[model samples]
Target chain A: MTVLSDIGHLLLTADLWHAALAAAVLLLLPALGGVISERSGVVNIAMEGMMLTGAFFAVAADLILHDPWLSALVAMVAGGLMALIHAVVSIRFRADQIVSGIAINIFATGITVFLINRFYGLQDVGHLPPSELLPNLQIPLLDQIPFLGRVLFQQNVIVYVALILLLLVHVLLFRTRLGLRIRAVGEHPEAADTAGINVYRLRYGAVISSGLLSGLSGAFLAIGISNTFVPNMTDGRGYIALAAMIFGKWTPFGAFIACLIFGLGQAIYDNNSIIHVSQYLLSMLPYILTLVVLAGVVGRSQPPAADGIPYAPGTE
Target chain B: MAASSTAAAGRPAPPLAASLRRAGRAVAVPAGSVVFAFLMGAVIVAVTGGNPFAAYQALICGGFGLLCSGGENAGLQVSNTIVFLTPLIMAGVAVALPFRAGLFNIGAEGQLIVGAIACTTVGIHFAAAPAPVLLPAVLLAGMAAGAAWAGIVGVLKALTGAHEVVTTIMLNYIAQWLLRFLIIGGPLQLHNGFSVSSPIGAGAHLSTLLPHDDKLIVFGLPASVYRVHVGLLIALLAAGTYAFLLWRSSFGYEVRAVGQSQKAARYAGMSVRRTIILTMLISGAFAGLAGAVQIAAVDHNLTDKYFSDTTGFDAIAVALLGLGTATGIVFAAILFGALHGGGAVMQSDAGISGNLVYVLQALILFSIAANFLRTLKLRLPAVGRAAGTPAAEAPAGALAGESATALADDEGLA
Candidate 1:
């Protein structure tokens, strides 16, 4: 009995770090997309669809190509293509950004299912073998440390890359004039235009960047986290990431922490004494947390002034 | 000058005509797009070597006309249709309500399922007594539970400044899981089976109405035709209540005011937080009621599949179709119910892919959303900002100032 309890305790304790890692990966996609959103002055709500599409493609590639790395690459490309459609519809045609994003999601979900069913003769896909997976990396000295080693050091490449991107994003946004321009366009594109920055060009660039990052998230989820994909597998993580982004008040570093909080909430629901609750309800934890944060927080960190507003040249 | 005065003349017929024209425009894209999409879906079914018409027939018969495959044209068919329509109505309202406030409540699926569970618990536990007392008590409990679930999101948005679209969507998954837990491990455990289900006590299950008959009566004739249940009445009442709240009350006014312009509403001295929270709660309650009715009236026991299904999300499509009105919700629900009813038919007999329904629905949403955006009118107070495009015109009685931002750049690249 004591041994069982101790094992249970260890599992529970270890789950927290696992939760954080998962949450961080989830957070990485939206934070990356949002950084671009703030830069270009739009919200990337279709992230759920994009990530789902990428996950499907990642698994599809691995199944077809039998190469995990190549599959991940293909997934990224697929994600990029999905985002590109969104950019064109919302940014170029001057469609409502949120509506456009939703459309992209609907499109991606429907298209992926339709195509996969056609190609594979069914809905579900086969899993990739271990040799086809992304190999995890370990930091030599640091990986030998106690708690941090397992939590931070000995994770897959995506986690390390996500952390590195977090810092790099900070530098790129705060240090570079281009970052200033992206923020400028996001907040007030008319002002950016006045300042000689091409608002159209900058906004387009931001949305594409969002696509790339979100795609990476999807690819990582399929290839690194798991070696398979099912229909609509990302299962609202993109939306959860959206919550994390807002929870962190839309700042990258802040979003990382917020994502971790969401991850913790997810872990708690699973590990809690309320073991009788449905997994469906348990999955809603992060969303519930996001709602709490959104409702509780003041409108302190506002989106750029022109964030969802379309920028037709000469209108302002 | 002459044309301008003519445009202004005698309570202009132009607005009505314009709206009609806009409505026409609205239906066009969806019609074309859906036709094309269905054509594609048909191709899919054909490719799969299924007869499209046979599938459509099967879908209609299976989804609405019968509980069991052989039950078609039996007394139970009509009851089945009403059974399917009940939650869809509530969910449609749930989706539409948020949309009216320029919000989206994607958590309806979660809210409905949880609400259903809450009602089922009360109904079952309380059912050790008389029917009349237990029924009303369960209904109230269900409503409260549903309201609480939805109200959480409302409260979150009010306090934290989060987007309801994302949060509600996330909450949906949690709700599904929670429903599963309750069913499989807790009070909802079934009577000796591997399936996760509950045993609702006697007198707690919803009773259907056939006016003068207890058995299924069709059109006041001989055979048992499905009559409506108390849920239909409750749904109707909810719709009427929403209409009253949205169009007539101060709170509704404030909600609309906030949705139109939160900054302006603040300037107008309206309590934005209270309105956001209150509206979300009310809408959520509606979703919860949907679940209650489904459990108490339709399925006596809980199923995890029902909790996690797309009904709540599909309600969003319904709400969009309904123009965010309660009356609209009813029609939207029926339309969606039909599609759901038709899905099996399309798949098995008609040689049209069952997924065509989703494609058509998505097309319709895209069309409505596009038309909704295209018809808005946004004019700035400043002189230099008055270059109004036709896409920004206000349709009669349709709220203006969605004066949407053309957020995309359309650089459709390779």
Candidate 2:
């Protein structure tokens, strides 16, 4: 009973909601990316690595270029390159997609740490200046609302962008002809290929787009949410995003709802003092919730038929 | 050999030669991958303005104690390599077993940790017990815990259709955090602030390869200098068991069949779900043993070091580069153990970062999966009809056999 009230009281605070929204955006971008990539029949577990690479480069580029937008662009390009490696290895060479993805993750970790040590010479990558950091904005009239304003209207620029991308991806995946083709390719690549849909191109495009969004999330993590980049700064958000994607049944809107739940967990973790329990136990909540959700929901979720199988043109 | 003598009565030499050639090619692929990865590493070192030859020289010296001039002894270096190889052998088998069953068990790391935790708990709680009784108890406890951890994934895969890949990765994080919780102001923590557990009683310690007395010397070093333990023998025994279970046993035949073609296995009256769960249980036991051995033989307690344990992850590469075979896994573990043991020396001697080894491992995975040489064989019409053709065609055949299993594991979750 006390625990329930504690959670209720915690939810009542606007700061918690805002933090939850921020956390959701962090997961939402990659979850959206995962949805798109997987919908095109490519399994992308490399998002964690890609995001870390992006986060590293974003900080490096921001430190050198001093422009947040340009640094973000650099981060996206870096992430796209990693994704291209995955696409080529899995699609072109017909390697196991999961192995390729795991390799990408290990490569990202090694290269990032190597570069950091080589470049910084044991010095820390300093934090971005507040003036140079990505700015948070508040809506004009909506900001005047007592509770909702603080929770929804005022947020980092990336939060708004993420919400917009969520809507755009939903429409693009469900409503657009391109979206239908992507789904068809994932569901039945041979059929799509026979229909002249060019399955490889759609898959490559979807995967690279996922990289771009993941990179954007990395940039936001470094410059928008936190001031500086740390090694493995993205942590397991990329993986959590993957869980969100699975929990959402591989849908943009569904992923957003799942992300909200996970993000709420993270936000509550961030404010652990008020929970009146061991902080260590609190730290386990997100993972435990994800496992419970997966055990419950994954049994019912139907993924694309051709997912994780490489398209061999006429082989199918 | 006895059957071959009768079968080859007419042309025994040719069949024997063909089998020898097939074995040679199997050895060559992994060897070529290592060389190719090293060449890539050289290029990276050159690009980074480091001396590639000097770095490699340092690695060899550190790994084998070859060409050592300073205070470093070959015995100590060899011992370090063996220590690193011990856990890798079991972990490698843990992964290899699953690969033969067509399940990618990425949760070995989690299984290993739970194993270590279980071993520590048992050792600490039964501190008064004799080594004869307590040692086996802790080891079995670890195995059981690890099996249970992996059993969760198997059950989920069988009943709920959850992909083991995602579940395993999620479990890795959970296990990591659980370690932190236990050692940092949690029940197992010895103090309020430290991220470490109390040491287990001495009875839990595995007998070292060398005598405990520092005055006693063997292989040009004091006995105490050798950290290698009886765990190495246990690892070897586990490998032997893996070989027997995978090749000589009926259950292994079912596992291989399920891995090759789940539908076919089912048609042959094999319970696909039972095989998967059992295979996972055995694999998890091996991984758990690796963890338990690591704690019992080396650390003697849980520490922050276990939090960053890469033994399970490295086992993935060991299983792959080893081509999912027991003998191949041992050799692969040796090579990786050498690299890990030599990493610090490369950093200190050649002025290159130790992470160069990781890059090399990843590159090896890339090149191995690309199967460039095999592709060349398939492309060349001359070679296509010759000795290399059948071997080149084998992966495709294997893929076809495993496709149903892979499909069930990946896309059939629903």
Candidate 3:
């Protein structure tokens, strides 16, 4: 009984809610990134790198701008810039999309480490001042509510923004003409192009959107839970987001739920038995989750017909 | 990875003559991709802060300079590269093989771990045997273990219609956890004060090669001590044999047929399910050999990081670069080996992080992927794909007589 109550107390803590909020943003971003990028018939697998890139820029921006909101925007712009690199290489150079995505991840990982070492002159940097930290927006009446308030209301702007992005992605993908064109491109780029849709334009749009959402996700990582930045901080969360996207069959809502579950899985696992579990086993949570999700959605995931396939003019 | 059927909606197969043409065309592109890949690598080195000439020299020196110095260190360097490449080559081939059949096997890391666990078990318990026999037994045991690991993925793919990618990945974690549990608790327990390593038996070790000259000279100076073994020969033999199997056998033909047109293959009486499972098993067996070699030659015991890093995921890149041919995979693996070998030197000499090599590798992969996407005007970056394009990639750059860009399909082949 004591152990059970202890577990309960731990679960209901402020830190747990923060972790949950953190996890939810990560899960939702990639799927939204996918949909937005799918507008051009591409699925950005470099979300990992973009998220990492954003994390770095978010801290850098916060350090310079001295405003958290400005820092968040900087993260988005940085992610977009990273996505732009991907876009040029993949769209123009006709590189392999998956490989291109991997390059982004690798380069981002390297550059971040290099810059951090140069800037901080150490293995890691200390946290920014409280003014630079994202303040929680607690609802007045909702604060009176017990568990619900803790879980939902008292998060930084990024958390609330994450929820808004989820709905926005769903609406953009399912309800709007822009979404239709994007889906069409993903489903059949050739047909979409033939129907007078500018395929390159769509792809550019998608890559840009991937940058934006992934940027937000990155911001959430640096400021939402912890007020410090670290290299490889996003770690494999981006890949897990990819898994969640796949598990959700590319639906924004589905991905949100999957992300939440993964975050919870991380939260529970992180708090509950990480130490007790084998270090190797514990480290492999995201990959395992990825595999499970992949398996679950395999055969069912009808990725846009042209998801990784680039668009060409004369080719069949 | 869309499902391919041997008998799409019901139709007979095409003429054998066309199959011959496909066989020829299939051989051509990967050959081209290889030369093209090398050229790209050269270009990338120039674009970075380093000279390609110096980097290449460093790479060549790093890989073979040890050998030129004479006796043991050279042999050791050779063997280490080969030993490392052995698993990479096997995993590369494993991935590439299924790829020809239009399948993706991204679970090589997991599968390799499972195989290693089994190999480690052999190293820990089995004693009282000579080097040759014990090593062979361990190798076989590793093969069986790895094969079973791949087989699990195969079975899942077959029965539940699950994607091999997901199943194999999940299985990798399970295998990893299970091995750790077994190693910590029961039969293979290290039981040695918090160390997560098993006590490997001396008898179950690889015989020393270059017994006399274990330490060799580098650049006219005798420096660096290491040993070499028979693993290099094994790696070469494995690559050659895989090449033979891919091009010479009826099974190879069936695999190609299924890959090119599953429905047609099915109409022609090919067993899609069996092939899928068998392909994964073959991949596993090869991976197991890699594990055995790593144990016998390098680490000599089951340790933690042994299961993790090695960039087994990058083997997919090697396979893609190789375009699924044995010789291509061998060269690609060697290239990766050299890259890894030179990474430390590059970082030390240039004051760049060893990860710069990764960045360069990623650049090369993404650029090629970018080249592929140009056709579709869809651009993205390959962060560190190292290599990409399972199909048509090798067709252009790998084969001897033919040449083409492997990046075509990755960009907009669909």
Candidate 4:
């Protein structure tokens, strides 16, 4: 069929791979954050909302400061504040993590739109100026490597940073002492508390770090990929990242792989002109695939034992 | 939340006064949370250079038939509130039912959409059918579609041990996309090239309680403008059914047993898997009925507007705010429906963002989670959960208790 051949041709083209890589990094950041947060036993479905907040703040800051890096930092801080709310409610008050997460999302959605009305007075949040936007790098020597170079080397700076952070998170989750404590806290908080590890603190840190990563992803989406911020511009990418997290069985490296698969789907959707399918129908591919993958893989995957339960001292 | 139930279970008030006091303590937290959020919303409005009082006044006028001004009739606002509340009651029950069984039915939005689509499909084809033959048929089709949509999540959860939250969210996206595909340049698009389906035949329309004559006036509005129909009664009946089925029936007892303790329920000879699946199906049916009612009673056709319909998401807030009680859901739905009705007026009159209502809703949920009012119970004589325990945390915790975290146990076996 024409659709199959067109997809094959698209796969062979370097542009498709390059776009997929960009999209993968976008998902990878949040997926990594999800891995870190869930690994520390806090369920975070609010990544979508947090990322949207980050995207809004990132664009707002960039518009004011004329510096992409500063805006990105502001975005991260904004996300951290949202996560702090989740931490206090779920960890301190022992609220249901799902409810708390959903609340954060709803809060972010309402606050962002409300702020827009206050700030812009019904005007659209405009695009960043060229000089103020995140710059793409074309590695002098590496860019010469034909297909691989175009797909991997010549990309935005955040892409490189995300790849490195992926490695760092992977290492932090598996190789470090703090990582062991976090895993212990997530798996069995009572045992971790008895072992003298600060369960609450680790969870707080992991959740905050997830917010930071998600925020960075949001910044990339606003300044690095898209020029301006739209209300709910992040769309469902945060949820897709969540799917990536589950598909990877909650591992940073495995999540990266899942992100790439989802990214490919997104990239293909972006290039829907070649595919002989409805654009709306094409948009459903990633979500349907997530459902299928979840149905197939969730039975075999293992999450931390105390994953959604709040750890109350002396409860056990 | 688990805290409320635990508090009720832990303490048994002896005298009538003690029982009243206990009931007061239970109502205080949610009521206080709502009040606190409104105060905070007022502050935010003031900070944004808008008059909070005026905005709230507009909200009140838009939500109910009181203090209306500037060409806005009191009757219209009340009618708007009723129309908005109709679907929410059923959708709230949809979310609330699964919460009792310790399952999160986040797929209600997707199910609602499918139900609407099914209702529209049946209504469009059977345009010639009279009211009696058509009404139940479209509603059943919608319910069937909604149940099928939710059934997928149930089966996945029952067999593969997938988290319903994730699956439901995924399904929500699919449903949104499916809706877009159907009405936009797809099979259902209107002939005039609008991104809406053709209006259903007049025979398919629900009859208005008030005569649709301009000569008829109630509260200064023509009866023809009143969109409130028999759907309100249906919603109320659905609420009653939800209460009876969830509280008075043996099946409800089984569901509660499974929710409270799956191990205990299994030991008591209950089939855990069947209960899980059945609860989801019933929940889906309620959500489907909401969608069906929305299409049959209000919209009369599929439109792009359904893409932004927050009925399903609002249902989550409704179910939680109501504490999963039928009376609570009705009251919560009315409150939310009022907020929604008032939002447009606030936007027009106060030159303020309609989204302030959403912010208020979120704030209320946040305050509920914080359970700040639970501390008040401590001042009362030996009642409520432990000194610092969140008394409002029980129901919400139960929501995620069995399903969200249930997969952890199986992860070990795998």
Per-residue lDDT tens digits for candidate 1, residues A187-232, read 7777778889998888778887777778778888888878887777
lDDT of each: 0.68, 0.83, 0.66, 0.85
Q: B224-331, model 2: which lDDT tens digit per residue?
A: 979999999999898999999989999999988877777777778777788878988999999999999999999999999997788888888888888888888899
- Top candidate, metric lDDT: 4
How much is B156 displaced in model 2, in angstroms?
1.6
Best by TM-score: 4
Error of 3 at A40 (Å): 5.6
* lDDT of each residue in A266-303, candidate 4, tens digit only: 78878658655667897787778778777775356656
TM-score per candidate for chain A alone: 0.90, 0.95, 0.89, 0.96
Candidate 4, residues B1-414, lDDT tens digits: the string is: 434565678874456766677677777777988899999999999997889998898888888856666568888889999999899999999999888888888889999999999999899999898888888898898999999999898888877777888889999989989998888888888865678987776666777768889998877777899998988998999999999998899889988887787767767877767788888888899999999989988899999889888899889889988988999899999999999999898888777788988888888887786675654454477773444445224565665455534444444434
- By DockQ thresholds, what CAPRI class is model 2? acceptable
List candidate 4 stretches off by more than 4 Å.
A297-299, B1-15, B191-193, B375-393, B402-414
Q: Candidate 4, DockQ to 2 decimals?
A: 0.62
lDDT string, candidate 3, A114-195, tens digits: 5664456656766888777777788789866777777888767677887887888889889999888888887777788889
Docking class of 1: acceptable
Q: Candidate 1: give its CA RMSD in angstroms.
A: 7.2
State, as a TM-score between 0 and 1, how close model 3 is to the true structure. Answer: 0.79
Residue-level lDDT tens digits of model 1 in B153-238? 77766655455666676677677667766666655677444446655666776776655354644745444346467788777788
